[model samples]
Target: MGLRYSNKINKIRTFALSLVFIGILIMYIGIFFRQYPIIMVICMILGLLAVIGSTVVYFFIGMLSTKAIPVTCPSCEKPTKVLGRVDACMHCDQPLTMDRSLEGHDFDESYNSKKHSKTKA
Candidate 1:
């Protein structure tokens, strides 16, 4: 199979959305434990927490979007936000990098890590 790639911000947003669905599913499951009030309550609370956490994550991503670098994706010819040193274009999921030295190199997420950069230096 080919490598699956997507915009980092989009990926995080998708995760947050999935968390909301999972939280709702968990809460629904809790309804079956009507005889065990404690278990049901606990499950409901956990589910609520997950949903709330997802909201917080969504908000955080919004704040981060403002700070992300804006660039035109060569492959897509569309403007997109880059979250880190390396990121995919939001429009086309085209891999991109801000570092000229890494230009034309394979898309490696590790390039953003300090350990990997230090080793190269």
Candidate 2:
């Protein structure tokens, strides 16, 4: 199968959502350890931490998204946010870039790295 690309913001959001689900699953599993109060409590605490971590991640991503550059996707003609030098269109998954020099080149996420930019210069 070919490599699949998705918007960075969407990917992060999905990860956060998965974290929430995982946290819930862990809490559910803890229910089976009712006889062992220590184990159950441990599991419950871990699950709570995971859920809290997900909330933090969501908040961080939301803030970053607000600062992202807004642009209309050429392929979809829909407004989307670009998180870095290179990102996929949220609506159409079209490869995008903010730098003219990098245009037409392969879409590489490394372009967003400071080391890459220094090397290019």
Candidate 3:
């Protein structure tokens, strides 16, 4: 078995989308507790919070993505955004790196961490 890698921005966006679905599911589940007013209210409130959290996450990622470096993927020749030192091409799964020292190395998400870089140095 081999590990799979995906674009960080896409991953985050997927997570946010899932959160919206989860929030809706929670709210739907609350409908069954209509007889228990307190429990129903609690569930509704929790669901609302989850949806709100998702909104915030979407907004934050959108802002962060705007700051990401735009580069053309060598494999696909399509434009994509790189979030950190190492990120897979958004269009193709080709591993990419901004640091020359990291070139030719196996793809590892840990390389994006400050602690990992410090230890490597």
Candidate 4:
């Protein structure tokens, strides 16, 4: 775990984009198994399924976007949607918090957890 925490939306987007490439690669590999029609068909179906799964995931992200908190990133001076109690800026990766008590303090993702926050309280 490095100190480079990414924006939640950006992370999910990356995953979805990677999934598309993986699905394509899997489908391409199916061509190599042309001698076995059944196996090739199965591989093709699996690859298609992966692509469909990614579409569902992307849709889920869209649904979640409606629930995210919109705020201006102090560091970037641009509006971004924060997905959780703690999230990084979409533009600059600066840590943002919805908690007033934690403002202007060190950025700790733990503050978003109920157990950790309660223990600190």
Candidate 5:
């Protein structure tokens, strides 16, 4: 397939990592605004919020883990978690689906957009 699909857990992990990096960058920027204590404080708070948000996201992932379907990836021969109706193998990035109807279809991220599905239905 032309489309590349990544594991849902991996995607969330990447998002968490980006949030952390962005938080640090924002906090660093606040250092440059030392002359304006108020702006610096606000920046610091915002940066803290980002980091905290990432923490919450991480927690949410943990909660999702309990609900994820555990399956062995055929391509990677590794155990992975499949979230929702469609997900990819965490180790090998192999597209997987719980729905039989979606089987053999080209992997598309749009499948995850329920609004798109609703409109089509």
Candidate 6:
């Protein structure tokens, strides 16, 4: 199967959503431990923390969105946000890059790493 690439912001949002679902699932599982009040309380508290963490993550993404560069995807002609040196078009999954030297090179997410920048230097 071919590899799938997603926009960075979308990936983070998905993680935040998963955290919410996981938190709910944990709380639901705690219902089975009704006989042990201590375990139930612990589970409930942990679940609440997860839900709160997700809220923080969502807020962080909102802040990042403001800093992200808005560009029109050439392939889709749709406006999208690019978060780093390389990002996929949100609408079309087409890989995009801001670095001219990296253009036409294979799309590798490692290109965004500090090590990659040092290599270029």
* Candidate 5: tens digits of C-alpha lDDT, residues 13-62: 78988898899889999999999999999989999999998998898888
Better of 3 and 6 by lDDT: 6
Tens-digit lDDT string for candidate 4 (73-105)? 988899999987788999888888887777788
CA lDDT, every model vs. true structure: 0.90, 0.92, 0.91, 0.86, 0.86, 0.92
Per-residue lDDT over 24-96 for candidate 2, one digit per residue giving the tens place of the 0 to 100 score: 9999899999999999999899999899999999999999999999999999999999998899999888999
Question: Model 5 segments beyond 4 Å from truth?
Answer: 113-121
Better of 1 and 5 by lDDT: 1
Rank all candidate structures by their TM-score, best first, as comma-separated numbers. 2, 6, 3, 1, 4, 5
Ten consecutive residues with minimal summed lDDT in candidate 1?
1-10
Best by TM-score: 2
Candidate 5 lDDT score relative to the true structure: 0.86
Per-prediction CA RMSD (Å): 1.7, 1.3, 1.5, 2.4, 2.5, 1.3
Error of 4 at 14 (Å): 1.0
After superposition of all CA atoms, the RMSD between model 5 and the true structure is 2.5
- Against the true structure, what is each candidate's TM-score? 0.91, 0.95, 0.93, 0.87, 0.86, 0.94
Q: Deviation in angstroms for 69 in model 1?
A: 0.6
What is residue 10's positional error in candidate 3, in angstroms?
Answer: 0.9
Can you list the residue pairs that collide in candidate 4? none
lDDT of 1 at 38: 96
Residue by residue across 1-121, what tens digits does model 6's lDDT show?
A: 5666889999999999999999998998898999999999998998999999999999999999999999999999999999888999998898988888899899899998999988876
Count of clashes, each model: 0, 0, 0, 0, 0, 0
Which is better, 3 or 6, measured by TM-score? 6
Pairwise lDDT winner, candidates 1 and 4: 1
